[model samples]
Target: MGKHIKTIARPALQSTIKGCGCGECQTSCQSACKTSITVSNQVCLKESKQHR
Candidate 1:
């Protein structure tokens, strides 16, 4: 017997460059995210007041 595999849906690709600077993967993530984060070079970062 063959086993059934489950598939997971991942977030969509970045919609605009602006969203990228604001830390969003795509429109769907931006709309779903409750907290604000920044994304650069395809990395998600938190905006901090102090440079750390």
Candidate 2:
């Protein structure tokens, strides 16, 4: 019997942005990472700033 293995789907991030910005999921920037321990900045600063 084969061991159960679930593959996690990585978010589609832009080359310009690098990471997905969701600290819980994909790897993000230190300045923008939003975790329980620390909240230095926003989740998606690049996208928000770009749209605005």
Which stretches in model 1 have alpha-carbon errors above 4 Å?
1-5, 22-42, 47-52
lDDT of 2 by residue, 1-52 (tens): 2378665655553563555544443343454344444333335655666699
Clashing pairs in 1: 23-38, 23-39
Per-model TM values vs. the true structure: 0.20, 0.24
RMSD of 1: 13.7
Model 2 accuracy (lDDT, Cα): 0.49
Error of 1 at 20 (Å): 2.3
What is the C-alpha lDDT profile of model 1 across 1-52, one tens digit per residue? Answer: 2268555755555543453465343433333355434333333443332345
Estimate candidate 2's RMSD in Å: 9.4
Clashing pairs in 2: none
Model 2 ranges with Cα > 4 A deviation: 1-11, 14-42
